[model samples]
Target: METKIFAKDQLDEAVDLLAKGELVAFPTETVYGLGAIATNEKSVKGVYAAKGRPSDNPLIVTVSDEEMIARYAKEVPERAKKLIKHFWPGPLTILLFVKPGSLPTAVTGGLDTVAFRCPDDQLTHDLIAKLGYPIVGPSANTSTKPSPTTAQHVYHDLKGKIAGIIDGGPTRVGLESTIVDLSVKTPIVLRPGEITPEEISQVLGEKVLINTGKVSDKEVPKAPGMKYRHYAPSAPVVVVDHVEDFAHIPLNAETGVMALKSELSKIDLPEENKFNLGNDLVDADHNLFGGLRYFDDKKQIKQIYVQGFDEGEESLAYMNRLNKAAAGHHFK
Candidate 1:
């Protein structure tokens, strides 16, 4: 199957395709998502097949507004309401109890709770509203691969696998939404993204706990991108906690390194093998996947060494993505 790229003005065609149960990749503020109608069992299954995503791993349902969330989810708790007021139409996904028989089991991964997000991007909002139903939109890449930020990235990974892609340009946040499980008594952050736990706590006037523990093999992940090794590139990634230690690590022609602009001078690799992520955490978040994808696309590069950042509030999401991309291959 050939993948067609649609302009923002051509979204009606894309929505029409989706209404017919065809898969379409669309942009969100966080990343491009492989989208299908949430309530359509066969269409939802096509999403898993297109991305090679595990059936047991749940997918996030995207809606245009808070009003649409009620069509799929039930019993929106008081705490979730507080969070929705502050974080909706942004990059935060809330886990809520699923409405019986509302969504297909394929969408929920057989779980009783559903994860939903209302992206801040106007293009995606308009598309969803036009479609008039929720869509299950996971990151638009093969499962466990680095999430796509640009339409080109989506085409690179999902070309010929999906029906069409809506080119809304590069994503703004460039990371997945912050996922918090409100289904439990105490809200636990399942995945960290642009929205920090500190900010969530400030809005709720209470503390939100981060789930530091691992999910066992027998357990099903409550959200997508949780159970698997995610955001990985074709080349092996090694995380360096300190920039100065780049010298101690051996380098060869097949190796490349990614560092911040401030630490570029500290890296000992050849100029061609080094990529700078610039100075700010926001910039780092924006370029993180692109840099990894750039090096991975280089046929000569076998390994990629990435500089790590301090786990401060600003850098927490950045480091979380890096850590996952490295698959825990960290050097102190």
Candidate 2:
């Protein structure tokens, strides 16, 4: 199937296609999402099929606003309300007890709780509002691949598999949303994103549990991109604790290195084999996936090595994605 690229003005057409149970890839504040009407089982299944995503990996439902939560979620607790008031229309997804029979099994993965978020992007919010219902918007890429921040990335992975893609340029957050499980007594962060656990705790006037451990393969993931080795590129990625380590590591023509601009001169690799992700943490976060994709597209490069960042508040989300992309292969 030929995937059509829709402009911002053509969102009405995108909404129409979604209402007809066709998959439409659109932009969120965090990343590009492969969207399907959440209420339609067939459409929701198409998302998993198109992306080769695991059937059991639950998809997050994107809503227009806070009030729309009632249409899908069973009940909103008082703490959840506080979170919504502060973080709605941003990069934060809350896992709430879903209304029985309200959404398809394909959406919740047979779990009682459903993940929901109101994106900060106007185009996506308008698309959901105009469609008059929620849409399941997972990262618009093949399962276990780097999440697409640009529409071209989506087209490369899912061009013929999906119906259409709305090109809203690159995503601002450059990472997925922070997923908090409100279904439990104490809210636990299932997946970390732009929003930090400290921010959530400060807003709620209570401590939020941060679950940073990897989920065992035996357990079913409560959220998308949790259990799987996600955001990986075709090339093997190695994470090094310090940038200086890259100088000691032997390099060949087939190797590529992703490091900070300051560390690039220290690495022995050729200019083409080196990708400088700028100096700021935000710069690294914004270019993390794009750099991986860039090196992965180079046929000559087989091995990709990345410099690890500090685990500070801003860098936590950046490292989370990098660690997952490297598949925990870190060199001290």
Candidate 3:
């Protein structure tokens, strides 16, 4: 359970363990993934057991390239092909109908579709190529917890539960890929991620369907992290409609504000306690977790007052992740 930080040379050992049906933590463009052989039902089950993930929430299959992914999917929709052409080897996961009996039931959560991605990170690609098959990789943390960015974070959450950890350093995106389901005739976005829906629409010439919320069970989801309470911290986080809502909150001497610099200046919070996460979405996206990590370190702060972003495709993915992290802590 002691997660070892494996180097490039040690990646072979990591793959060997995975091939033998043992779990290994490896890096991807989005976040570190707790991986096992996707085709091996027992190995895929280990991923669920290790992360305490539910069977109904499916796992994403990580492959080295587009061709590798084609084998698992029954048919590739035109929209999916356009996206793969434009964004493969990046932080984008496309859902396709599973080729009957090609992948184990566990990978699909018994659903008809499968989520597949070719990560941009070299370590993950190399690991997949070495293993010679797709790997079942969900974020390397317990279901509904903050996604791990580094190997240490993986160890912190999964130290005693997994077999090994391949330390690929911090993830570049620090969030999961946008999951687009192409199984339906019209493309539906099962999950929002770093790649915005607007960006996806530009490629496919159609609006992508946004998920109602992460915890909604209205329909079967195509990927992990959708059916759980996720990206949570130790303290309660409340998302407000505007800065004025801050006044009604009782100053219990344990609350702090997380907002844009412009909003932070307007608020009356003590300068020391005010958490200004950048003025715009780009910087805010980068600062989101760092702010949460800071709060985690402070420990004394009991409540986090988060401000919502204005509506736009650019802000959609960031807001989606933010809302989930807050987990029903939002105000109109």
Candidate 4:
């Protein structure tokens, strides 16, 4: 299969391909998502096959309008309605009880609940609206890899496996959406992203639950990224607890460092081996995945050492992704 790269204006081509049950990757503010119409079993299955994703790992349903949500979700409670009103078209994914058989087993992963997100990107909104149905969107990368933040990153992992990619440039968040499950009686977060639980609590005027514990492999996850060893590069990553910890290590060409620009200045590591994480939490979130991929491109970077941050609520999303990539490895 030839993977054609489509520009922002060429979504008509993308719509035509998707209608034919072909897979197309499109950008959201978060990351590029591998899109297959949720109603098409074959196309949705192709998404799992192409990405080598586990069949049991559920896919997110991306919608353009409230009508689509009403059509699929079993019941959108008052709290959920307020959340959608406040956070729709943003990096918040809500898990709700979906209508039975509304989507294929391939889409729901045979689960009764579905994850729904309405992205903030105009091009993606237009694509879904024009297609006239929701699409199953998983991060457009091979299973257990760093999620693709750019079209090139998608192409790097997917290439000829998919039909084409809609190049909407670099993603803003560089991480997946915050997934909160409303399917149960009490709402709880299954995954963390740019949207903090505190922010969600503020909008709903109720305290939100945030227990991001790693679900057991035997259990089917309610959300994506919850039961996978993800965001790893070719190199091993060591999480440095403090910036001054760099002084205890030996600097070499094969050793790479990912930290804030301020922290990078204090390390004696080679400029070529360092990837800057900017100066704050937001910047760190934006650059974290790119920094991992940057070392993969270098090839010779045998190991990566990254700076760790305080476990504040605002920094939870950044730390969640970083800890996953490092697999909870702290510097010795």
Estimate, for each residue in 161-219, the C-alpha lDDT of model 2 and write its tens digit.
99999999999888899999999988898888889999999999987998877768777
lDDT of 4: 0.90
Residue 88 CA displacement from its true place in model 3, Å: 0.9
Tens-place lDDT digits, model 1, residues 129-229: 99999899899998888899999999999999999999999999888899999988778888999999899988888878887888788888998766788
lDDT score of model 3? Answer: 0.81
Alpha-carbon runs more than 4 Å astray in model 2: none
lDDT of 3 at 186: 71
Query: Candidate 3 on 249-328: residue-level lDDT in tens?
Result: 76655787888898788777677667777878776776666566556556778988887777677777777777878986
Score residue 95 of candidate 2 by CA lDDT. 95
* Clash pairs (backbone) in predicted model 4: none
Runs in model 3 lying further than 4 Å from the true structure: 213-219, 244-249, 261-276, 293-299
> Which lDDT value does model 1 have at 125?
94
Q: Model 3, residue 35: what's the lDDT?
A: 90
The alpha-carbon lDDT assigned to residue 185 of candidate 3 equals 69
TM-score, structure 4 vs. true: 0.98
Q: What are the models' TM-scores?
A: 0.97, 0.97, 0.89, 0.98
* Higher-ranked by lDDT: 1 or 2: 2
